[model samples]
Structures are given as C-alpha cells and as structure tokens.
Target chain A: MPQISQLPEFYVSQIFWMLVFFGLTFLVVGRGMVPRVLSTIADRTTRIAEDLAAAEHARTAAEAEAEAWAETEAAQRARAHDLIASAKHTAALATQANLATATARIDAQVSAAQARITAARDASLGEIEWVAADVAQDIAQRVAGLTISADDARAAVKGAFTHG
Target chain B: MHQFQIEKLFGADWAIAGHSIAFTNSALWMALSTLLLIVFVAGGLQRQVVPGRWQMAVEGFTGFIDGMLAANIGPNGKKYVPYIFSLFMFILFANFIGLVPLGLIGLHPFTFTSHFSATGVLSVMTFLIVLIVGFAKHKLHFFSLFVPHGTPALMVVPIFFIELISFLMRPFSLGLRLFVAMMAGHVLLEVLSSFVISGGNAGPLLFAVAGLPSFVLMVGICALEILVSGIQAYVFVLLTCVYLNDAENLH
Candidate 1:
C-alpha cells in the first residue's frame, strides 16, 4: 500500500504539522476554555448553595420571631386575664361592703320605729287611766251620792291594771 | 490508493532541510479540525452560569474525558486532562469529519487519523507522557510496571521480560488500532463502490445482483464506519488512560 511506501517521505511534514495543531489545541481549548466552563459551573453551584443557606437562615429567624410573638401574646393574655379577675374581685368586695352598710341602716331605722311605737302606747295608757278615774267619780256621785277621791281611785285602777 | 495519497497543496513544494515544509492535504484537514474544535470550544468560553447548547456539548465531552481519567487514573489523573482531552477531541473530530461524504461535492476529506504516522506520533506522545510521569514520580521504580504485583518468584524474570515487551508495544498497538480501523473502513467502502461501478458496466443482471447488494453493503458499512470511528477514538483514549494508569498508579 502507498500508505506504507509513502510514509518515509511524508513523516516529517505530518509530525511537524500535527505537533503545531495539537499543541495549539492543548493550550487554547483544553487548558484555557475547559477550566473556564467548569469554574462557571462551580460558581453556579456555590451561588445556589448560598441562596439555600440564606433561605434556611431566614426561615429559622422567622420561626424564632413567631415563637417570641406567641410567648409575648400569651403573657399579654395572662395579664389581661389577671386584670379582669382583680377588677371582678374588687367589684364583689365593694358590693359586699355596700350591702353591709344598707343592712345596718335598715336595722337602725326599724329599731327606732319600734321605740316610737312603744312610747306612743305608753302615753295612751296613762291617758286611759286618768279617764277611767274621772268616769268612776261621776258615776258614784250621780247614782248613789257616794264621794271617792281621785288619788284613791287612781291607785285602785293602777293596782288592778298591774295585777291583771 | 489515490484517495490515501498525500499530495501537496498551494502550488509550492517547500522544504526545510530534508523535511517537507509544504502544506499538504493532511495539514489542511488538521488545521480545519483544530479550527472547528476551537470554534466548538469557544462557545463554552461564554462561561454562563447556565450553559447553552454548544457549551453543554463542549462541557459534556470534557466531563466524559475527565470521568474516564478519574475512573482509570484515580486522583492524580486531573493533571493529564489537557493532553487527554486534546487527543480524544482531535481523534474524534478527524474520525467524524472524515466520514463526511464530501467527495460527492467534488471535495476530498482527508482523515489524518487514518495515517499511521499521525496516530503513531500521537500515541508516542501519550506514551512519552506516561514515561515522563512514571520516571518523574517513581524514578527507577517505573520499571516495576513490567513485574506487575503478583508474579511468582520463579517466573519473575520471564514475566518481567514479557511484560516489558507488551508494555513497549502499547503505543504501537494503540496507533495501529486506530489507523487500521479507519483505513480498512475507507478501503472497504472504496472497493464496494468500485464494484457498483464495474457491475453497472457489465450488465443489468449483474448490476441488480452485485451492484445493488454492494451499494447496500456500502451503505450499511457507512453506518458501521461511523460507529467504528467513534468507538476507535474512545478506545484510543481509553487505552491511553489505561497506560497512564500504570504510570500514575503504578498498578
């Protein structure tokens, strides 16, 4: 074959040119471009990783904030509940105090009214005794001409009323 | 045979000393393949965070060679990426471009990879890298590639000689594998096409029986040739990596 026969003549040029081309390829494309491309990919990967990490950080922060908010809200709720309970307790104590004052006033008014009624009855009883004493004197003088003293008659009436 | 002939282009037969400095058809194709490869790789130089189609293609091939080296040569294989990448791409481009039916357009596509001298130089360069690396790292112990790991004490000498011979044959075998595979495919296609022509002149009967089948075979072989071209380039690189394995890992 000419491939074999022609080789000795063709060798130098082929090798020379092959070296030139292959050398250029190795330098320009292989060494230069390949790394550039891979570095870009590596950059993208790191960027994505950073973004994910930032997102995770944000998520954690939000969760912590929510937890704090919940805690504060619970405290606020408890404070409000305490305020309501204390106000209710104060209102109940005030009501009890007012009821005690009203009850004392009513008891005083009722006892004073009873004292007035007793005094009136005692005054009427005194008047009734005097009337009876005068009436008896009149009856005795008009019907049988017997005279009786007011004092005696008064005493007798007193004794009879007292014993009865 | 004429298809395989190296002819001078540009109307001048120039030489430097005894060496022919004239630009030949082979040189033109080599330059063309380099330019094409550069253009292909230039797309990747955009360096976008997200790769485009051309960038992806370039990166895909780079990653493929990288993966192969990583698999074969272990951690230290990274240093040889540029050389391996260049060799693989150059061979792959030559193979694929050679299969282009440019002859139909009255233009011949010379596949330099089909030349033993071209593949020989490349394989020898690869072998040299191994040798240089092996010696640089291991010094005199680079010779241990011949003894292997598990040779019995009695047969060590014979095994060492045999291994040494086989180890030396690596580059030649590598060059021959690619060169023969490519040359044979091209020759087979040329032969069958000639059959188609000869049969046509003989008779319609022969044309129908022989020319048609020959044409069909040529078509089938054309497809196979494409596959073979890719496989051969891969095989060349794979073997280079394996040889490099001995150098880098010393296994």
Candidate 2:
C-alpha cells in the first residue's frame, strides 16, 4: 500500500525522528531517572539492615547484663550458706563445753555426801565398844564371887567382837 | 485507510544537507510519546526512602527490565539497559496512543509503529548494536558463530550458508513482525468502524441490527490488539536481549 510504496520517501524522515526522540528518552530515563529509583531501593535495604543490626546488638547487651546479675546473686548466696554453716558449728562446740562442766560439778557433790556418811558410822562403833567392856566386868564380880581383872575382861570381849 | 496517511503538520517541504527533514504526523506522535515518557519517568524522581505510588510504578518497570536483562544477558547486559529501556517505552507508548480515537475530535492519531519504516530502522539499529558488541567482545572469533561445534565436515558448507542467511534475516523478521501486526490490527479497527458508520447511514433499524454485532466484534478485536501491542513490545525487547547474549557469548 502507500506505507510500502512510499518507503524511499518516508523512511529517512521516520528514522531521523526516531533517532532524535529515542536518543532523548534514553538519556533522560536511563541516565537521569533510573539511577534515582535504584538508589531509593538501595537506601531502604540499608536502613532495614541497620535497624536489624541495632536490635540484635541491644538483645546481646541485655543478655550479657542478665548473666552478670545472675553471677553476683549466685556468689552472694554461697557466702550466706557459708556463714550459716559456721554459726551452726560454733553453737555445737559451746554446747559440748557446757555439758562437760555440769557433769564435773555433779560428781564432786556425790563424793562429799559419801564421806560424811562414813564419819557418822565410825563414831557409833566407838561408843558401843566402851559400854560392852564395863558391863562384862560387873557381871563377873557378882555371879562368880571372884575378883576378875578389868583388862582381862576387856581382852575377851574384844576377841569375841572380832570373831563375830 | 485514511488513519495511515502521513500529513505534514508544519515546516514546508524542508531538507537539511540534502536530507528531507519535514515534520510529519508520524514525527509528531513519536515526539509526543517521548515527551510523555520523560514526564512519566522524571515526575517520580523523588528518591523518597519509602516511594509513593508514582515512584513505585516507575521502580516496578525498571525492576522488570533489570530482571529481564539479568536473566537473559547476565551481568554484562546491565550496561545496555538504557538502549533497551528506550525501545520498550517508545514502542509501548506508540501502541497505546494509537488506540485512542482522536479522530472523534477531528485529530489524527498516527501510530509510528504501524509504519514499516519506523520499525525497520529500530530493528536495524538493534542488529547493528548486536554486531558491534559481538565483534568488540569476540574479535575474529565472532565469525565462528556460524560454525556448529559438532557437525560433520562434509555438511559444514551447506549449513554455514543456511546459518548466514538466517543471521541476515534477523532485522527483517523483527521489523516485519511488529509492523505487520500493528498495521493489520489498526486496519481491522478502521474497517469495522467504517462499517458501523455506513450501516447507520442506511437506516436506524438496519444500523441497530448490523452495527451491534460489528461493534461487539470490534470491542473484542480491540482487546486482542491491546494484548498484541504489549506482546510485540515484549517480544522485540526479549529478542534484542537474546541477540545481545549471542553476541557476548558467541552462542
């Protein structure tokens, strides 16, 4: 049709304009506009990455602080446990010392009571021996109508008492 | 048929350095498309940390191209983004603008892509770039592109000739695909619209009966054309990328 037949006449002009317009579009869009769009995308990605990194850093710091506090608490608890154990040990030692002193005092009181009892028995025995000797001498003089010596009666009484 | 007519808007039959430089409807639309693209892209150059809607749209388009280049051409293809982006934006805008029925307002909406001359130039430019890049990267080895690595020596001559012809046809095929598709779609729309108008002139009753079906079919075709427009643009750029890859990698 005319589009095919008039190619020689129109082709040059079409190509000419095509070059002009196409070249302008290429320069303005490719060189001017595209880079801006690309940069905007790059900026957004960078900001997101930065925010994530900051959050991770904050989390790490918080974890470290918690760990440190836990360590301190553990150390203090161990110290308190040591103090309690030492107090218990000292109380036991003091109770043992007090018990030994009380037992020694009770033993002394018992020995003193036994000594007094022995003294009272010895005095009664002496009195009984003297009475017996007198009685024996009198009986001999009355019944037998003989003069018996006092020393002899006493010896005989003493021997009888010893044998009984 | 009248939609495809090229009329001079300004500048009397002019030429510069023995070259005709008349400003025609085709040139005006091309300029308009370029202007709109500039405004669209430049308007969103806010560099906001969180992009607004306009910025998001612009960035989305850029990312689409970036991903395409990365997938097809690898990292080295990034440098050619400007050229490829320009082609995509120009063709896309030209296609969409052509769909507007400015004739309802007594204004001509000339689609540059419907013209073979325009698409031919574009395809040739792309092919030239491929050649330049191929030679620059591979030097004398670029000629080895026609030679299959594991072919019988006896069949090499015939295969080489076929490969050479295929290689030479790249530009014609690329250009013709876009031009023919665009021209055919617009011509169909023009014909269907004229039919509706002529049917109405017959009588109101006949218009209602005949025009309705034509109108519905035109609407369907319009939707198809829109799809084709987008696909053609994508195909053009995708083929460019593939050619570039071949140039760079020699495959």
TM-score of chain A of each: 0.66, 0.54
Docking class of 1: medium
Which whole-number lDDT from 0 to 100 does residue A8 have in model 1?
79
Interface RMSD of each: 1.2, 1.3
Give the least accurate 10-residue stretch of model 2 chain B, judged by summed lDDT. Answer: B8-17
User: How much DockQ does model 2 earn?
Assistant: 0.47
Model 2 CA deviation exceeding 4 Å by range: A50-164, B204-209
* Worst-scoring 10-residue span by lDDT in model 1 chain B: B10-19
lDDT of 2 by residue, A51-84 (tens): 9999999999999999999999999999999999
Shift of residue B163 alpha carbon in model 1, Å: 1.2
Error of 2 at A41 (Å): 2.8
Per-residue lDDT over A70-100 for candidate 1, one digit per residue giving the tens place of the 0 to 100 score: 9999999999999999999999999999999
How badly does each model clash, as a count of residue pairs?
0, 0
Q: Pick the candidate with the highest TM-score.
A: 1
Error of 2 at A47 (Å): 4.1
